[model samples]
Target chain A: MNDVIITAIQQTLIEGNVETAETAARAALEAGVDAQTILNEGLMRGADIVGQQFEAGEVFLPQLMFTARALKAAMAIITPELKRLSAESGISSSKGRVVLATIQSDIHDIGKNIVSTMLTTGGFEVIDLGVDVPIKRIISTALDEGADIIGCSAMLTTSMPFMSDLIKTLEAMGQRERFKVMIGGASVTPAYAERIGADGTAANAVQALQLARQFMQNALA
Target chain B: MDYLEIIDRSDSGEYISEENWDLEKVAMTCMRLVSQYDLKWDRQNLVPDDPALADRVFAAGLALAVEIGAYNRSSERILRFERDELESALRDMKQTLSMGQGADERVLFARQIEDSRPPLVWAGNPGAPHPEALFLPAVVSWAQEPIVDLITCGTLAEVDGREVRTGEALEITATRRELTYLHQALAHVGRPGMGMLAAQSSVSELGDLAAANPDYLRTCDAHLVPMLNELKIDNRNIARAVNSIEYGMRNGGLYCAISGGLGGDAPGCALISVASMILGLLTNRADYHILHPIHIRHVATSTREVLWVESVVLQAFARNAPAIIVTDVYPKSGALTRELLYETAANALAITVSGGHLEGCGSADGLVPHATGLEPRLMGEVGHAACRQGVTRAQANQWILQLMEKYEHVFRMPEGNPGARFDQAYDLETLQPLPEWTRMYEEVKTELKEMGLDLSG
Candidate 1:
């Protein structure tokens, strides 16, 4: 059982095939292996390999999409088992909800997809509103979904200013305190993030996950 | 393989070109010297500066002329019109133009190549003097006749934020004007020239430029596609041609191109990286030139490692691509001194002589189209000598080592102070150059001349 679970986890991580990873998780549960070990070893490890492949240029957008799909596949298979296990043990709780969108007037979604994949792995349920979403709609979604945080992605130099506008609009709406805004993209630098008054900034997908977690924790505290 | 079939067949993916001509016959019958002479052939017999190779190139051009028989369609590489043929074709095309004759295919073909020749650097608003324009006298002086290695007509924008004034016209009208400017500027430069194209400032979208100016797309041979139609053909905003497909031409303005330089290159990756980069260039040959645009300043390890690795990469890419490549070099800090200039020139020359085609001279990044002067000329000397100096790898290495030294100091300076742009950095006429500066250009030129660089010739 341990061997099957771990090998599936290993294959998921290394080969980036999420369905196999999911199958491994399901099989492990049936064989009485701990569900937590399956996910912690399988899904997270799968993500790390994808990130590495992305950085190494061994995987570009198309490959990244496949890995993300695989990760989702594995996660879908493991979710109920992991949840049942957590419910039985009484250790799991809702981590919080995050909303992600490529900011207004920019259509680039590739980077946004990478960040979303990582965030999902980090235990947040994300609602992606897609690209060219206007500021009012983003703020409204935050309010409507009772989201814990909002992540904005703008891939163009011309369009990134709207991220700041979103924040400013939140302030004008007098609900700035209700949301934690984090920005990511190729054109938006850390200095720019700071100048725009974003709560935090992310350079790549890995940083995005780390920043989201940190921002959520600090906001709660 | 009729490469044109590659474009013609839309749905038949992966079919051996339906035209069924053996690859060499099509390559030879057409004037794609880059394709015909490219690494597929025996490179041992060819050299760019070698009179024989250039002659072979000319012969290839003539063969294409013979194959086509008459100027009925635009040629790919063959500029076969003889003095008589050119006159007849030119007369007939002009007659067509005057009489509104039915589709001057010969003229259309000639115009296609002419249009493809690097958009003459359109120096927009040349009539108004830019403080930057002050250096033009020295630049033109240095560039006349044999010194004109290749010129892309330069343009300057009068921009107010995101909007350029040119954007005021109907998007399509402005585009036609922009295309007209390209054609007009090509005529203005007045020689069988090189293309350095311009964009119609920033408009809403690429299509708007055409939609606003339908006249820009007014060519009768093809209705679905008009304007520049090779593939991946692009006009650099400055000179940093972005992304591979953009290099290949995302819009209609493009003839296909392969991106050069490593946007995400890491150390020890040069040989493999450059080898792959060259492969991408050849996969599409009409527009993309297989040149390594090298830079050391950006991250992915250290500068020296980047430069050294890129040198090897450039040599390999140029050798394998068997095509013209432009090498990008960064200018270092400090005053514009001749020693520093030549040192950089020498380094560039070494790589280029190893068989790089065009050279992106001096601080070749976001700072492209930097008041063009000494850098390109100095770089050209080394590039010229590259073909002449070393046929063997080791000889080219030694020659580049000698050249790379003079310009290493350039990197040390505060960013943007390329020695060639000294006029902008400081008043060149008023602020006298340091003694070492005066001798540097002379010394390097003399040495390059000795190395068989024909700067004048």
Candidate 2:
């Protein structure tokens, strides 16, 4: 029965059929599978494969976006039950919480949105601060939310200096070690990120999710 | 009828949710219209050589304008235009834009497909980062070139020993300084009245507002009011357009549409590019349009796929609207290299033969400050040669294929080391390209002549 449910979820997400994915989630609940099990074995399993194909170039942006939409639909149907199960068992659903924003003076957010989508699907809770975000707002939110990581994006080369400024601000507050800093964008490179004192840098959304997971593991270690 | 009317309409239009405008309505509607029109691309000929196909793309682009309109990100609404309004704008749009005053003035007019006229050349460091000291030198480097008709400039990485933050007071000061340096550069070149494409230092509307004065950016100069990528706009751009129009300045639209993002692929991008051109007309009331379709991966338009889109879109506007279109040449490689020259030749050749004016070949994807005046001169040289030879679409396709074979392998490679800065590429004392850079340019021009371009005039 678990195998059937997993296959149903996988096929629905692969096809990007949102209604069918939602229906599959409901059916799995009716068939006596626990919500955590369903989330881990069914929804997450399907999303993980899609993310893999995307990174491998077997799937393109349009296909990955569609699959993400379908997975969101399935997660919507299963979220409440997962919350109930977590409340009863005293456990968490996500790996760690992250706060992401596009740095100030530039309003391009395609990369940020992609990273948020991939991170959320990879079992991390994400607080998206949208585009052209100021330095104080980003730092304060990360502290207030107890964020495990703060990722910033700047597509223009002019806005790239802001990432350096953000890292400096965190240091000035003496809260630098509390959260991992990740920077990525079209104009940003790994060398630039390291020079700016970023803990991690991702070239694309798939790599970003992997970097987030590594940050979480390091925190636990 | 004017920019104020458009601004008021953008603010007062029916409010829709951002979700519907960005995700659900825009892309889905564009996809549906693309399929319905049965538009397809020919990879061999980057610009569609067929007149009928060009007309079809134009019609489809107009249909898209009437359907999707332009989404206003600030207002959360779509600014719709009547068919009559669009038609009138097309019918009465300026054919020739007189840039600059008196002895330094140049006229930018429309070109038809295979038109034998020399396309206008506008050159400068287009938003590339420069050290405070190098900014003026870079402007002089581009303006001192005899072939360059207009000037744009790079921005200073720091002003007054501090970073120039956007939407801050420093932005206004930096922009004013940019124009001042430009005025000085023109005076140095003995063309004191040369027109400039203004506000290259402005990252927001505040910078533009500060520089809109007569001394900094004159009414005769062109102001670049850009549309956000993939059919979106904000209040900053709207304000720039409204202010420019009200001040009797000629506002032009500068749009860089992502190929793989909303446009889907090469063909979809071509359609979207056409739609973006029309959107510029309706929203900004632009005097001229600059179409830039960039690859999401390489962040340039030098690839054969992108060249084809540039060709077809130019033909669409040329054959249908009489709209003056200026195409951008964004190479993946940095300047002062053989690969950069080849990419520049291919991009310039395609634009010249397709009846589109060339804006620049500089700054290497706008990621580095590696551009000098030499590449833009080479661009003008090659462009003039193509126009004189009356190059056709078939001949251009063959030449470009040969050109791409030289550099497309490393098109996606990362720039491990930084590109050469302005000081390294040019001599600031003489405002001339370095000896090595000039040799490389001459060598590439000779190589082009050997490749049957015969640029030896």
Interface RMSD, candidates in the order listed: 10.0, 2.4
lDDT of 2 by residue, B35-137 (tens): 8877777666775688888887788888877777788887887888877777787888789989899899998999888889988888975767677788888
Q: For model 1, how does the per-residue alpha-carbon lDDT over B321-376 read when each residue is reduced to its tens digit?
A: 23333344433322245544544454454344444334333332322233334445
Which 10 consecutive residues of model 1 chain B have the lowest summed lDDT? Answer: B221-230
User: Residue B46 of model 1: what lDDT?
Assistant: 16
TM for every model, in the order presented, reads: 0.53, 0.94
Give candidate 1's chain B TM-score. Answer: 0.47
Off by over 4 Å in 1: A1-4, A49-66, A83-156, A184-187, B1-158, B161-195, B203-378, B390-457
TM-score for the A-chain in each candidate structure: 0.83, 0.90
